[model samples]
Structures are given as C-alpha cells and as structure tokens.
Target: MSLLVCESFLSIQGESSFAGRPCAFVRLTGCNLRCRWCDTTYAQEGGGTARSLDDVVAEVRASGLRLAEITGGEPLLQAETPELAARLAGLGLTVLVETNGSLDISVLPPEAVAIVDMKGPSSGEAERMDLANLARLRARDEVKFVLAGRADYQHMRELLPRIDTARNTVNVSPLFGALAPAELAAWMLADRLDARLNLQLHKLIWPPDARGV
Candidate 1:
C-alpha cells in the first residue's frame, strides 16, 4: 500500500533521548485530532507525495542512517504504517515512531521504539488518549507530556501515581513558547517527579518556524 507522506529527510533528531543524533524521518500525512498546540499543522492537510511502502523503506535505506523516525500528522492514521515500521526496522535502523497516544500502537513492530505523546490539560485533547495503549506500554516505550502551564503540571502530578515511571522514560516539556522549562523543572524537583526534562533541540538550532529540520 502507498502512504501519503508529507516529507522525508535525514536531519538531526530534535527531541527525545536521541536528540542531536542524525536521523531519517518519514512524515506521513493526515490526523484525526486537532491539538491546539500542534506544530506540524502542515502535515494535516491532504497534499503529499504518495509513496509505496517499499519506496519509503528505500529512502531510509539510501540515507544510510542508523536512526529513522515515522512521524506525522499521526503516522498511525495510515493503515500501512506498521508495515513501513517493520521494513525500516528490518534494515537495522533504530526505528522510532513519534505518535500521539490516541491510536493502537501494538501494530508497530517491537523493534521500533514508540514515543507516545500523552496530551496534557492545555492540549484540549487529553481525554482522547487511548488507555488501552497506555496499559500496553512496555519499558521500551516512552511517554511524553508537553505541559502548557501550572495547571498542566498539577495534572501530571495526579497522573504519576497511576503510571510505572521506573519502567519507562517519562518526558515532560514546556509548550514551546507558552511556558518556561525552568518553571517545569522547579515544579518537578519540588514534587520529586520522576521524569526527564525534554527540549526541542531542533527549534533551538534553527528558527522555530523552519521546516524539514
């Protein structure tokens, strides 16, 4: 099956533990949710190149990168994403799928590390997270929360007791320009929250508005 791919390129990873590493990315098109703070709104539209699964995998292979990511407009929105993920992993690349926690992630290959972004209070889509997927989270998976304010941080505090933070990497980041990382860090220290502070390294290196970074 062919996938509607928004963009694909090899660039330095700007987020997660793999930040600063060169990675190939396949940005698929389409999304079901409209998160207010979405950065890749351009991906939500229908205009994109239609690439077959094999073709997409070929691109990654040609890049000669050890790391590759399938991002979105919610990559899982397309039925072929799991197959694309498996093929990428089959090539010995460390496959990462940057996903919103609203779809069924079990479809992805076990070799791919799933970075599930769990919506926080200010995203307006917090309730849309699929609890079933959250329950299936393994230690290999990562969960992220982009906090927008003190209210979001408080909500995260309430959510911590329900999660197995020791088994997985819990990532928290400020909502880009809405809040400061230092504020979130201070709150984490005061509450003794077990989480790693996440920053958009790509945004720091390039203008936040830059594309294909």
Candidate 2:
C-alpha cells in the first residue's frame, strides 16, 4: 500500500522528546482535525506525491539519517501507516510516529515509538483526543501538548497526574511563535510541571514556512 505524502525530507527532529536530533521526516497529507493555531496548515490538503511503501522506505534509507519520524496532517489517516512504520523500523532505524492522539494506536508496531499529540484548549481539536490511547502507551511512547497560552499549559498540567507519567514521556511545547518559550519555561519552573518543553528546532535552523527541510 502507498500513502499520499506531502513531502519527505531530512531535518532535525523539531518537537517531542527527540528535538534537535538529526532525523528524516515523512510528512503525509491530510488530517482529521483542524486546530486554530495549526502551524502545518499547508499539510492540511492539496498536491502530494503518492508513493508506495518501498519507495518511502527507500527515501528514508537514502537520507543517511537513522532516526525517522512519520508525521502528518495525521499520518494515521492513511490506513497503511502501520505497515509503513513497521517497514521503516525493519530497516534498522529508530522510527517515531507523530500522531494526533485521536486514533487507535493500539495497532501500531512495537518497534515504532508513538508520539501522541495531546491537544489542550488552544487547539480547537482538544476534545477529539482519545484519552484511551494513554492506556496503550509503552515506555517508548510519548504524549505531547502544544500550548498556545497559559490556559493550554494549565490544562496540560491538570492532566499530568492522570497520565502514564512513569512509562510515557509527557512533552509540553509552546506553540512555536504563539507563546513565549521563556515564559513557558518560567511557568514550568514555578509549578514544577514534569513535562519536557519542546521547541521547533527546524524553525530555528530554517524558515518556519519553508518546506522540504
């Protein structure tokens, strides 16, 4: 099976626990949720290259980056995502999937690290997050929240104790340009929220609107 891919490129992993690491990114097309502050609105639709699983894996293998991230406009929208993720993992690379947390990740391969985008208030899609996915997490899985303001941060803080804090990596990222990274850091320092703050490392290295890494 193949996927409608927005673009596949090599860049430093920008979010989650893998920030700043060299990684290959496979950004698929289409999403089920439309968050108001979504940064990748371009990925929401339009032209994409439809590539077979072999071709996708070949592209990642050619990048010379051992860490690969399968991101979206919700990659799970593509039914064959599990196969693609498993294929990438089979190639001896550390495969990570950045998902919108609304899908059933229980079927994802064990070798793939799942990064659930746990939407907080700022993202209009907050209510869509399937809380059950939290129970499916393994030590390799991570839950990330992109905060646009104080309300979003506080909402995430309220959710911490209920999450699988021991087995899961809870990451809190201030919406790249929406919230002041320093301010978010200070809040984390004050309340002692046990979540890792993520910055868009790729945006720091290149234009936020630029594509193809």
Candidate 3:
C-alpha cells in the first residue's frame, strides 16, 4: 500500500520531548482541523505524492538517523500512517507520530511514541480534540498543548487533572512569536504544573518559515 506524503527529510526534531535529536521526518498531507496559528498549512490539503510504504521506509533508512517522525498536516488523517509507524518501528528506529489529537491515537504501534497535540482555546479548534485519547496515552507517549495566551494556559491547567501526567510526558509549547516563553514558564512554575516547556528548536536554528530543515 501507498501513503500520500508531503515531504520527508532528516533534521533535528524541533518539538516534543525528543526535541533536538536528529530525526528523519515523514510529513503526510491533509488535516481535519484548522488551527488559527497553524504552521505548515501547506500540507493541509492536496493529494501530495503517492509513495509506497517500502519507498517511504527505504528513504528513512537511508537518512542514517535512528529517530524518525511521522508528522503532518495531520499524520493520522491518512489510513496508512499507523502502518508506516509500525514499519519504521520494525526497523528498530525510534518512531514518533505527531498527531493533532483530534483522532484516536490507540491505533499506533506500542513501539512508536505518540506526540499528541491537545488543542487549546487559542487554536480555535480545541473542541475537535478527542478527550478519550487522554486515557489512551502510553508511558512513552507525549501530550502537548500549544498555548497562545493565558486563556489557553488555563485550558491546559484544567485538562491536566484528566491526563495521567505521571505516566505520560506532558509538554506545554507556547505559540512561537505569539506568547513569550518566559511568560508561559512563569505560569507553569507558579502552578507547579507537571509539564515541560517545549520550544521549537528548528525555528531557532533556521528561519522560522524555512522548510525541509
């Protein structure tokens, strides 16, 4: 079977707990939610390129990177995504699937880490998030909240109790350029939230809008 792929490259992972690690990325095309401050909107539509699972796995293998990420648009939008993640994991690669949290993440292979995004109020599509995914998180899985302001932070705080942070890594990523990292850090510190502040390292290493690493 083939997957609709947008682009794939090897670069430092820019988000999640795996940030800064050299990772091969497989960005699939299409998304169900339209977050207001969405980056990579270019992958939100279009058929992208149809690539066989073997071809995609071969490319990641050639990257010579031990870590690989299946990102989007919204990676889960494609039916073949879990298969891709499983394929990567079969190769003994540390696989991560970056999903928008609007879909059920339980479908991914246990070996593949899930970096699930929990849309906050500012994303405008927060209501679309599948709250059931909170209970489905695995120990190696991560849940991220991209906050734009105090309102979003509050939303995250309220939802924290529902998530088993002790089992899964919780990440709070302030919307780049929109909310100051220090501001979000202060809020987290004040509340003693059990979540790490995740920054987009790629934006710091290269131009904020540059693609393909």
Candidate 4:
C-alpha cells in the first residue's frame, strides 16, 4: 500500500527519551486536529506525495540510521501506518510513531514506540484527545504534553495521575517561543512532577522555521 508522505529526512530526534539520537523521519500528511500553536501547518493539508510502503522503508534503510520515526500531520490518520511501522521494525530499526493522542495507539505494532502528544487547554484541541489511550500505553510508549502557558501546564498536571509514569515515559514540552522553559521547569520541580522536560532539540540546533532538519 502507498502512504501519503510529506517529506523524509535524517536528523537528530528532538523529542522523547530518544532525543539527541540520529534518526530517520517519515513525516506523513493530514492531521485531524488543528492546534493554535501547530508548527507543521504545511503538513496538515494538500494530501502530500503518495509513496509505496516499500519505497518509504527503503529510504529509511538507506539513511543508515538505526532509529526511525513515523510522524505526521497525524500518522495514525493513514490506514497503512501499522504495516509501515511493522516493516521498519522488521528491518531491525527502532521505530517511533508520534501521534496527536486523538486516535487509538493500539493500532501501532508493539515493536514501534508510540509517542502520544496529549493536547493541553492552550492548544484548543485538548477536548479532541482520547483519554482511553492513556490506559493503552505500552511500557515502551511515551506521553507528551506541549504547554503554551500556565493554563496548559495546569491541565497537564490534572491528567498526570491518570498516566502510569513507572511504566511509560511522560514528557512535558513547552511550546517553542510561547512558554519559558525555566518557568515550566520551576513548576515541575516545585510539584515534583514525574515527567521529563522535553525540548525540541532541532529548533535549538537550527532555525525554528527551517524544514527537513
């Protein structure tokens, strides 16, 4: 089957526990929700280029990186995503699938780590998030919260108890240029929150607007 692919490239993983690692990225197109601070607005529409699953896998293999991430507009929006994840895993690569926490992550292969972006109140799409996915998280899976301000941070704090951090990794990411990292860090430290402070390393390494990093 063919997938609607936006662009594929090699870069350092900028989020999750795998951050700072060399990785290949397969960015699919078309997101179901539109967050106010969404960075990849370009990938949300236009139905991107269609590529066969095998072709996509070959690109990652040729990258020579052992890490691969299937991200999107919303990767789960495509039907063949699980098969693609399975194929990449079959290649002996550590595959990570980043989803916008609106769909059932159970559809992803067990070999693929699921990085579920849990929308906060500031995103305006928080209501679209499927709380059920929190219970569905696998040990290798991760949950991320991108906060735009204190309201978002508060919202994330309310949901933390529902997630089992001992089993899954929880990431608290401040929306680039929207929230101060130090302020968020102070809040987390004061609360003794059991989550990692994840920053978009690519944006720091390069221009925030630069694509194909």
* lDDT tens per residue, model 3, 1-213: 999999988899989889999999999999999999998999999968999999999999988899999999999988899999999999999999999999999999899999999998888999999999999999899999999999999898888998888889998988989999999999989998899999889988999999887
Q: lDDT (CA) for every model shown? A: 0.88, 0.88, 0.92, 0.94
Q: TM-score per candidate, in order?
A: 0.96, 0.96, 0.98, 0.99
Instruction: Indicate the worst ten consecutive residues by lDDT in candidate 3.
Output: 157-166
Sort all candidates by lDDT, best to worst.
4, 3, 2, 1
| Model 2 worst lDDT window (10 residues) | 158-167
- Residue pairs in clash, model 1: none
lDDT of 1 by residue, 2-116 (tens): 9999999878998787888999999999998899999999998789999999899888999888999999999999999989988888888888899999998898888889998
- Clash pairs (backbone) in predicted model 3: none
Highest lDDT against the true fold, candidate: 4
Q: Name the regions of candidate 2 deviating beyond 4 angstroms.
A: none
Q: All predictions: root-mean-square deviation over Cα?
A: 1.1, 1.2, 0.8, 0.7
Clashing pairs in 4: none
